[model samples]
Target: MVPSDFKALIQRFYQLQSERIETYRLFEEGHEAYLRTGPHYDFEHYKQLVHEITQAFSGISKEVLEIKGRLRELDQADLCEHIEKLQSKEKQKLELTAKLQLAKQQAQDHPEDEGCLEGIQEIKHEIIKNKEALSEIMQDFKYDSEECD
Candidate 1:
């Protein structure tokens, strides 16, 4: 039989996964609505939906960090280290994403500016690099988790 604390941890993990899925679904719906409505779409509402998705992911990420701390406390050092690495990669990805967004906005606001265009391109490359790094981290975590099972 599984220990109660481990079971509870698993349950919480599943719950966070479910919430992330639901949040992604809502964000997709809002995106589709915006695309369909085109120029007439309410940008604020779509932005709010995007914000909700970000908040949902942020909440899950925080929980995972806490879980990693718990695992460390329980002497599951390998798993905790994997989680820590994943979290670090995730943070880098988030930072790159924010930079990309800012660069895109600058490009949009100054379409004729060569510097702005160059900045956007550079930021896009950085974002792609960070995404690839994050993907590798995720794969490593998956392999580690599977080995544990």
Candidate 2:
């Protein structure tokens, strides 16, 4: 049987993931507008949106890391190993998120620069790749959870 605390963590993780996805969608919409219209894009609003989503991502990542640490303390070797792998992926996700934020800031600061626009596009691609990797990691975690049962 799965521990109640573990179940709770999973639920919270899902909730955070849902919020992150929605925030990402909004950011994508804003980014697409900026890409199409260039100077007409609302830089301040775009920055604010990215900043908000980044903050949310930071909070959720921190909490999930804490939960993973707790899971590691449970003394179940296989489960602990699985959590470690998940944590590693989470770290990569956080790094990608930071890169994405930096790219957005650069694009905002240098709206007229082609290099800045290209950097944003490249970083967006990296973020999407990282998200796919994260999805696979989550799937692994689910499989691990069932095996633990």
Candidate 3:
């Protein structure tokens, strides 16, 4: 594939990866909400969503490897490092989001108390910043190559 084709492939991989990640995120959110509200919602839906997300992620993992191989600039270790970082960051984001939701619920339950809402918002802000940094890292490979041309 030409460089343009490779770039397009990379972009598509990122899009699919994002979709898969978002699916998992929704499952996480649903799980958290269920934990707070007891048996009020369809917890099974979240479980199914998680299953589907895992399947989607499995498919994308193969595609990511194939695309990276075609790009010829990334080795197995490099790809592994990126995958590890993405996975770690994603897990952290989910955990932080869950904590934020729990804190919000506590604040709601205690109307007069402001228990760690500011801290929760700050954590959320940091998560956003971390996500932006991850996005930059993902793009770094493509942009760095362009600079050589």
Top TM-score prediction, candidate number: 1
Screening candidate 1 with a backbone cut-off below 3 angstroms (N, C-alpha, C), the clashing residue pairs are none
Q: For residues 1-104, could you state the per-residue lDDT of candidate 3 as single tens digits? A: 23566457557757866775677677567666655664355557656765775576667666666765655553334444555566566557656665776666
How many clashes does each candidate structure show, in the order listed?
A: 0, 0, 0
State the lDDT of candidate 1 residue by residue for 1-149, as single tens digits: 33456556645755764675576567556666755554465678778877877887798899987887776666667767767776677677556655765565555556788898888688778867866875676566556644544
Candidate 1 local distance difference test against the native: 0.67
Q: Which stretches of candidate 2 lie over 4 Å from their true place?
A: 76-128
Q: Candidate 1: where is the Cα deviation over 4 Å?
A: 1-54
lDDT for predicted candidate 3 compared with the true structure: 0.62
The sequence of per-residue lDDT tens digits that candidate 2 reaches over residues 33-57 is 6555554656777677768867876
* Most lDDT-accurate candidate: 2
Q: What is the full ranking by TM-score, best candidate first?
A: 1, 2, 3
Model 3 misplaced regions, further than 4 Å: 1-9, 20-83, 144-149
Q: Which ten-residue region of model 1 has the weakest summed lDDT?
A: 1-10
Q: What's the lDDT for residue 6 in model 1?
A: 54
lDDT of 3 at 42: 56
